[model samples]
Target: MERSLAALLVCVFGVTTGEFVLAGILPAVAGDLEVSIPAAGLLVTAYALGMIVGGPLLTAITAGRPRKPLVVGLLAVAVAGNLLSAVAPGYGVLFAARVVTALVTSTFFANAIVIATSAAPAGKQASTVAKLVFGMNLAMILGAPLGTWIGEAFGWRATFGAITACCAVGLLLVARLVPGDQPVTRSRAFGEFTVFRNQDLVLAIAITAVANIGLLMVFTYLAPLLTGPGAFAAAAVAPMLLVYGVGATIGNLIGGRLADRALLPSQLGALAVLVVLLVALWASPHPVVTGLLVFAAGAVGFSVIPGMQTRVLTTAAAAPTLAIAVNASAYQVAAAFAGWLGGRVIAGPGMTSIYLAAALATVLGIGLSAVALRRDRVRVKQSVLR
Candidate 1:
């Protein structure tokens, strides 16, 4: 149990660091590559797009195979991608490297969730999944800030180098801890799509996507938001991010417990909190207040992720791995859309508009969650009657 948990943490830390380190180094990348900041921002978007595409595709292709080799292979690819970026001659090559790494990272992330949940003792599945996800939030707290500091002090390429080292470490851990034999209890990859046909699962994914859209809309522009007028200085951005990470870590732990106790209520409460917090952010721009709200937003938004995953996994019990993988893909796709939306809103109105849009999306997500809960209750009653 300890080894499996450690392995999951290592994989998640590596992948999350690789995925989010870009956000902290965007400015440096822009200057180094001689591209406009917005243009350089495409690196983040490209990576997200890769995840959106890679999650389901890679999972389906590797269905029923031993997960260890696939995870190690993906980590190797991530390391290579970061290395390529570290040495790439120009923006184009760096962008390509990010895309490749993103695809590999997505596979690793989805598989990590599957492995974590499957390895957990039956009743403790949510908690196990939460521990794995905690690594992701931990990356935001520790990895992103450290990457930002390194990129600022040394250079953006140094951030990639750091991620490469982390990936190497992750590969070693995975080899040692992950089971050598493939678990072949289920070979129903195609049937996993049946999860989509289930209204509850469909609504769950839809709300998950909507919630992420709002979350990422603000997240993609968080550095800018913090560094803007009346906000924190550029140097303070990392610390603020650390606070957000704290919130996310708390959320991950609390969310798992909440889901284990009462899944739907936890989901609804998290979404509602997110909506309120985002609206508050839109209304207030004070650095101290905004920072707290940002932390709250991270805490509330992330709290739903584990619960959502649990819901989908339960709904598609026969093919939990595929269901979880597809849900992971939905998250990235929503992130891509949210980033684009933030860019659009930033272009039109300004940074403040990003939060406003996010707040609106959060409200929509809350409504979706409410409907899902109602539907679930009705289904439960029907099952009891039958």
Candidate 2:
């Protein structure tokens, strides 16, 4: 909609690309650095850990400054991080570089939510946040595939180099298009957590975490799932991911619109669909069927994201930015947890177990969403009577 919002979206796209491009190139990185695959996986783990720590910390530290400059500065950090990764001589250097990138990633991700909501028209705030989130999904859909292609064709370093260039473009757009606005000076760090005292907000965040656990559980192991015995050929992975990306793009737009129209019902339906889809993915025997189910899983899982975000915004009206930022951090925490859990399952039982666990988590998320809806209705009735 707004030029400023578009600029922020560009920044989000670049940040997301920089953050996740490593997934597609991990094998190359492992080979190049002479590390095991599990160890190379630490690059993703390290970034998530950084985000878990950095999101709230940076949100609080920058609470007193202007948002535009802070966002621009964070993008600069992302650019530098990617550049460092491109030139890393060893696994340790790459890991450190990922952490640095995540620090900026956390700050930028949280602040973008703040800026989007602030810039939107009164009733469209949640929709604005969803549009920014669309950039994130698109990055996964587009960035990872493209990065993998580049990595395969050139080298993993080239993928990182390309991301560095994208970050540069994002920085230039932020500088040119984003309006100069002072940050919300009244918002404090822990003040946002007060929303947790509201049962609906707490439930909403929990639902978000649960939903993500399901999504990331499968996603974290997608490559291996596709390449393992009875799985799709290596040549099919990129094409299947392209299908998944399309589903993700559609899901993001649908989620935003549904949330804008009817938040609770949309969320409930999405969670239910996600649970069913995950179960179906676990049950599918054929590789093509599994690939299609993966696409369905992406569609349904992402379709809930905007609704969950809007639910938090509505429940925590007092500190929307802090709540949203904290929620972003929560998602990363969920991702890290999901990755760990999925890894454990893969090591113990198999990849199928990850989807089974995800399905169970999605069911739990549905129950949480129901509780949140009931709590919100109770609050509304009380306010009306008052």
Candidate 3:
């Protein structure tokens, strides 16, 4: 990878750490801010909402700008937001700061991925995108745990302060390293929305939304599930999470390779594995079994992500920036839905229900993938007949 792309990867790691650090340090934030845990939890909701609303909108608005400077500006927003988070005196200020940071985070993801793919050598697009996303997976694997430990050792404010410093470094690296490219063409922001007219691209978006909902539904409540029935010691949670993260990283690389060879089959196979693993996790009570299943779940679930991302790029070849931005927004939409639905399921039906619910969502994603595959076959047939 180029030094510039490596910097972008580190930038992604920082942004993703910021996104998930709140989850690991929620109790500290709640206590420090004098809010209920549930209320403090709304910070996550606020961030996801911002991503859902801001990603496409901001990407469309900046569609014509030079990507390098745009990325630097977005990273500056992240730095400011995190700095505000580090010193916020009330829940409302922190909430607003998180929203602002999330807007920058999502828009940055859209722009960064476009840059990664654009800068990649011929026939290696999926692999480059996977490397970029691997940074996010690394955050889940290590950064969140470290941030949480810092919060416990010092304070939640300290965690945000560290994140702010990280963002500042990322900003400098992006500004100095990423190449500046002039606009190829210019159009109204509304014109970007026209990519939605493509049914294949829309299906790709649905796959992202549904698959992520399923993935996060289980992940958002994973701690309780691990300790509740599995009877694992509290100390074991972090290690188990690491195992899952490792699996996720492996799956991400595998998925990229598979997508290059066989996109449709790779996605189908991954979702199928995910559905089976979710069911297995629900039934297994042993800690070892649970840990193995958790790893497999992460592996299989994430294995399809690159395929879904690349699908949007291929299908919306003419408007990949908007399509990919919409794709990122779809993930945020799924996250919001997963958080709400998982909460309801945990409250009403109990914790195990979260996995079952996620399984159902994955099943839907599988159905959608099947439909997309069928459509591809028919189009191929028509081409041959013509």
C-alpha lDDT (0 to 100) for residue 338 of candidate 2: 84
Candidate 3 has a TM-score of: 0.95
Model 1, runs deviating above 4 Å: 31-36, 185-195, 223-235, 285-287, 343-353
Q: So what's the TM-score on candidate 1?
A: 0.89
- Model 1, 94-170: lDDT tens digits are 99998888876656776777777776777777777788888888888888888889999999898889888888887
The 10 consecutive residues of candidate 2 with the worst lDDT sum are 182-191
Off by more than 4 A, model 2: 187-196, 223-231, 285-291, 344-353
**For candidate 2, what's the RMSD?**
2.5
Global lDDT scores for all candidate models? 0.81, 0.80, 0.86
Which residues of candidate 3, in runs, are more than 4 Å off? 182-184, 347-349
RMSD of each: 2.6, 2.5, 1.7
> What local lDDT does model 3 show for residue 153?
93
